[model samples]
Target: MARPRAFDEGEVLDAALRCFWTRGYEATSVRDLASSMGLTGASLYNAFGDKRALYEKVLERYASHSMAERIRRLEAPDIAPRDAISSFFRETLERALDDPEMKGCFVVNAAVEMGPHDPELRAAALASLGEVEAFLTRRIEAGRADGTIQNRETAQELARMLLGVHLGLRVLARLRPGRELLEGVVKPALAALDPHVPG
Candidate 1:
């Protein structure tokens, strides 16, 4: 019988995710992944299939791992809709400010870097965005029903707008990476959603 693999698959995927997150898909060579994951090139191939395959797993892992917390916060039953939306953006900005490389979001970066050329990545990116948009749409609909949100726009419309803002913030973070700058960008966007505060 063949011997079992020695390394932890989860650990290897996490390391690969970080490598791709930092260096990007095109820039990160197979050797880079192998080194980062502390595995030989042959081992990486044997385990993950190929560099592209590893990246696909990394994207899935990122959706489940890095993006899960935000989705959880947005989906919390007890949290107010406006607060949930605000806190989500605030947390994203906070994390971006704390990041030394200011790499922004991995999904957003991947969307820009590989989206046009790669159908698979584009679909994955869209699926990831759809998850967030769905959560936002639900939250916005709930807020409208409760009269906490302004209810000026349809939930779907508002969700798309907020999603755009979130994506923009991520892009801006890559260039500015300042708390104040990110806050400046997010505050007005959130403020516009407030019924009490005149637009």
Candidate 2:
């Protein structure tokens, strides 16, 4: 029979996410993952196959883990989707401020590092954006029907613009004067999303 796995999968993957989140996929070596997880290089290979395999798992964990929870919070029934989406950006800003490490975002980081010329990685990054945008579009459409938001734009277009704000905000968060600069970006974003626009 095959030997049982030695390490806790969840703990190790979370560590990998943090490492990847901090250093990015290409910068993290197999030795780095092994040392960080208290595993030998061979053990890591046996458990996760290779660096790309491990990085893929890290991306999966990032989605199903706390990231999904954030989406859940935003889509929760108790909060209006419009309000919840606004709070999501503000909350992310707070999270960035609270963490002195300046990790930015996992998906945004991946988008920068691997988005171009890599079909698989680009597709994966785009799928995540699609998920968020679809969710936003649904809510925005609902809002439009209920007289909450103006129906000037299609749901799909509005969703894409909202996602653009997130992408831009993550990039801005990595800079030196991040928060104040982000506030400028965020405020204009809020105004653009406002339902009542005087003609």
Candidate 3:
């Protein structure tokens, strides 16, 4: 029979996440993960397999707690579709502003840093990004059906554009976390949703 592990899995995983978030995957080492996770090297390997496996776990954890939860809250049936879209961006902007470390986003960082060479990582990163795009597409479709979003573009097109804006905002925030600059970036995209606003 296998022995039960002694450490708190959630706590250690969170620590590993912080380590990876602070230092990109390529830069972070097994020793770093062990230190941050408060586990010996042997225990780290025995429990989590390896760096790549642990990183995959961390990505799953991040998506569940961050992206999945946010989508669930903002996509509630009672909220107006347009409002949900607006609130999504508003909350994203707020989070970017509030991040003192300017870590940007874990999923996005993974997509850029390691997604190109690593197929598994690439798929994982794309899946998270696709979730956001899917959410935006759904909301835009709803808004259009309800006559609230008056954009000329199809829901998919608008959703893709908004997803680009979302990615750009997070990346730019890392370089310049200024409120005026970020809000300026968002204003025009949001305006595109209203027909009354002259294109």
Candidate 4:
């Protein structure tokens, strides 16, 4: 019979997440995860399979808490699509500003760091990013139909450009974290959504 696990799964996973978030996948070792997660190496392996497997779990948790949660909240039926989109960027900007460690974003970091070498991680990263793009495309289409956003471009094109802007914001936040600079970067992109604004 298997022994019952004593440690809290969520707590240990959060610890592992912080360790990976700080050092990233390639730099983080199993010993580091074990130490941070308060588990023996054998216990960690038994419970989480392997380092790669644990990291995959961490990515899923991150998406649920960050992107998935944000989409759920901002896409409420009562919320205007344009307002929802604005609120999403506003919250992202605020998070970047408030992060003293300037961690940027976990998914974006993973995409850049491990996407080139690891096919599984690359697919996972792209899938996570695709969720954001799909959400943006939906909101833009809604906004256009309601006459709140310009129709100068198709929803797909606009969403792709905004997705690029979102990626740029996350990457730049790590390096600069200056309010004016980051806001300057996002302002034009948001402005382009205005129905009255020239394309």
**What's the TM-score of every candidate structure?**
0.95, 0.93, 0.96, 0.97
Error of 1 at 14 (Å): 0.9
Please give the CA lDDT of all the candidate structures: 0.87, 0.78, 0.92, 0.92
Alpha-carbon deviation at 166 in model 4, angstroms: 0.5
TM-score of 3: 0.96
* lDDT per residue as tens, model 4, 40-136: 9999999999999999999988887878989988889999999998998999999999999998899999999989988998898899889999999
Clashing pairs in 2: none
Off by over 4 Å in 1: none
How well is each residue in 15-83 modelled by candidate 2, as lDDT tens digits? 888888889887899888988888899998999999888887787677666666777768878887678
CA-RMSD of model 2: 1.6
Residue pairs clashing, model 3: none
Counting clashing residue pairs in each candidate, in order, gives 0, 0, 0, 0
Any runs in candidate 2 off by more than 4 Å, and if so which?
Answer: none
State which candidate, 2 or 3, has the greater lDDT.
3
Give the per-residue Cα lDDT of candidate 1 at 191. Answer: 81
Question: Model 1: which ten-residue window has the lowest total lDDT?
Answer: 190-199
